[model samples]
Target chain A: MSLLQTIFEETFKISYEEANQDLAMQDVANWDSLTHMDLISAIEDKLAIRLSSDEIADMTSFDAIKRIVNEHQ
Target chain B: MHNIIVFGTGKISESCSYYLTKKYNIFAYVCDNDFVTDEPFLGKPVIAIDSVAKSYPPNEYAAFVAVGYQELNTLRESKVEQLTTLGYQLVSYYPQHTPINGPIGHNSMIMDDAVIQPCVTVGNNVLVWGGAMVGHHSVLQDHCWISGGCAIGGGATIGERTFVGINATLGNAITVGRDAIIGSGAICNKCIAEGSVLITAETPTYRLNSHQFIRFSSEFNSRN
Candidate 1:
């Protein structure tokens, strides 16, 4: 699985099939503000890239996160 | 009076500067080279972090990193490391009104109205915002951020870099692991694993109209 997919699956405790670019915060049951921070931390830990609060706030969807990871990489 | 330089010009830095001005002489505000600004901060000169060492030597002046908890507190941690590497004495903020019975680590900011009970040990670079209560004998590890109005019970051990949101409550003797995130209004009773995230369930709102449920005094008088 892709890095983004793996992050979504582990952080959200969702299945790989449920993790997709179209998946948004509103679509997930456990994607609260706390989980959002956890996801950000997880991404940072896995990718070794630090994200500012603005970047974290802008990550509303999987596609946005992918874009952010790409930009940082 | 001891001269101290405050890093950053954000709200946290401003508050820390204000807190330090009472006891120490405010030397200057230091920011990154990329932060473009020529304005004076609270009537003090704003200089770049790299340039601070030249004018204000580490032996003569101290430093306080007033950055907030961002990126799971890694940003604040990095600033702490940078300030320490510069050989500046890192100062902590503990308001006179806030009772600290035990040792609090350097570079931590315990804001006003925070009640830290006896035997509470707070680690370095921690930020316990206003009105937060750290119960007796609780231990907060390095780089933790406890938001305003949080109630951490006695004997609780909060791990490194954990972020406890506003109004969260942790029960007595509970151990929260490293890099954990406790959401606002969450009541944690059990131990939280490392890198875990705990969020409270959203409160369900009632949809019934209040006026429809009220019993009028006139109706009671008519019945009498």
Candidate 2:
């Protein structure tokens, strides 16, 4: 499994199958603002990449997060 | 004295260790393998969390997640949950200089000079910083951050992961919702809803009673 997928599964308590590109914050039960920040921090730490406030705010979906990760890469 | 392993190498961990050393002997500072450093913390060796269970063992020592109230205390809560999952008994720190006539839940921290009045229920992973005063019969929910010098009135219910900023006054019998951020110097008497960002230039006094606070507190209790 991809690192991002694993992080999503752990953070949202979702299955690996559910942590796809179509996944959105509204679909997750535990996707509150605090948990969202946790997800961002986890991503930054695991990927060794920093995300700006705007990118963090816009990363409401898995697709958006992937786009930001691509930009950092 | 029992040996306690503190998680983190930052200032909060240093402060926690200073108090923890008074009651228990600090074993080592625990951090993730990714962030492990060569230098010691507060004169003790730093151990990786993954290897701590093998070296120290959970049955022999206790753990204190001394992480600060970052991400609205969720980070501390996560560390507490991690330690619990590893079968480590979590310990709460009740600072000296006040007799807390209340029950403080596991992993909660009462910093120096923080007063907890009678019948207060401090939930798990709550962080009450120095000089904070929680009045009688208040309910501080899990993962809440009561900043330094904040005065919480009696019978008030602080919501989960909510941050009552420095010197913020939560009037008597008020209820603040989960994830709400009350800025510094705000004296709030209103029922703050979940995810609210309340910023005040001056203390705004408004009385909200008759079941609103009760409702929010009940939801908070039922969740935990």
Candidate 3:
């Protein structure tokens, strides 16, 4: 899956179209701490890769997340 | 009456002993894995845990796992399964002092001294530690642990596998997502999304009459 699509699906638990740069971190209703960990766990499980604590902490925006995921790829 | 034996000597186990012994004629009170208590608990003989099988057949007794929350809920889950596979019926204990409004599903170990207010929904295999209070209309999903002295407010929904730390307080109308850990003594006034970790800043204390030229304790107390 594309990184953008993954982020959108992860943040919103919705389809790819819902994922956009305009998506605010706090706007999503389900974007609680438990779901945040679920998103990270899902991404790692899907791509078979682990994200560093620094990378995880720094990930707050779609653009920054794209960069981190692309580097992992 | 059915033969119900409570394992472990923890506070929960003791409460179970006190309650169940009054209701049923329990065969023996299982103490430590090795030594049995000389006196009976509430008039039932107290024996060691390991001697459970030796004294009676596995089918002869129903066992309740009264141990507290282990590392990551591992200890309770493992012991529940172990007792079941041994052909012993798994018993659940819920205190009547807890005012549960909605249906509490199977195998819940609710300790004494906890106050579950009205309109609270608790799922199966859950543990409500002693002195915890579930406020009215709060929905707690399955496998959640509400530690001792924790207070969940009304109109809150705690998702599955979540751990509410000791004395953590959630304000009314807040929603905590699945698998979230509310740190000890945390006071949440807003919705915590799934998997979030929250901590509250701790206040320092000092002796009231240390000649420190100030007194803050009485002032803080009166304000609240």
Candidate 4:
């Protein structure tokens, strides 16, 4: 499994296969304001990266998160 | 005196850099990678942030992120995180004559004449501009900016990155959520949800223009 899948599955309690760039907050079962923060923390920790406050707020889609991760890398 | 590296060249930075001189020896002003130049700021050398650690090692010199309230202070938050990860210790600034009666976090600044009442908990990267009054037991969360002359009532809880604008007033025990904006001169007395914007109505002039009003009001009042 990809690192993004692992992180998303771990943070949102979703299956690894369900984690994709097309996925968003509404598509996920348990995504909320609190869990979104958890997802951000997980992404930052696993990627060894830091996201700006705007970045954290704007990362609604899995695609956006992947984009940020790629850009930072 | 402690050696300090100030990050930013804008007005807020200039003011804090001046006030910081009271406690710290000025080292230099650092710039973002995009704003690199040989020009000096406030008569101090401006160094590129990318190479600041090489000449002014973080082990010896402390850092202050003097960025202003752009992007609801998220910009400053980003800079603080960047600088901290680079191994520099962040420092808070309380200008001369500013009264701080509570616990404030790192890289925050309380400007001149601002009064922090007892037991107020101020979080990281907060900016309280000049003449602001934060009431007792209020909790100001991280990355918030309280503009000049703002009066926050006692026991109010301000969430992260919330902006209380100039001369705004908040009633006692109000809870303002994250990413909220209480505009200038607004009087807020109730709880606000996240991402709320409270803008006061613009004051409209009289039907007559200023000159016409001045000419007509001489009998009643000339202050128009």
Poorly placed runs, candidate 1 (over 4 Å): A1-73, B97-102, B203-224
Candidate order by TM-score, decreasing, is 4, 1, 2, 3
lDDT tens digits by residue: candidate 3, B137-187: 888886678888998888889887788999999889789998788889998
Which runs in model 3 stand beyond 4 Å of their true positions? A1-73, B20-26, B29-54, B97-103, B193-195, B207-224
TM-score of 2: 0.65
lDDT, candidates in the order shown: 0.83, 0.82, 0.69, 0.83
What is candidate 2's TM-score for chain A? 0.94
Q: After superposition, how far is residue B145 of candidate 2 from its true place, in Å?
A: 1.1
- Report the CAPRI category for model 2: incorrect
Docking tier of model 3: it is incorrect
Clashing pairs in 4: none
Q: Rank the candidates by lDDT, best first.
A: 1, 4, 2, 3
lDDT string, candidate 1, A1-73, tens digits: 8887999999999987888656776677777656876888899999899876556767777888899889998
Put down candidate 1 lDDT per residue, B30-118, tens digits, no spaces. Answer: 98878838999888899888888998999999988888778999988998899899999998878775555566799888877688888
Candidate 3 has a TM-score of 0.56
Backbone clash pairs for candidate 1 read none
True contacts kept of 3: 0.00
Best by TM-score: 4
lDDT, candidate 3, at A53: 61
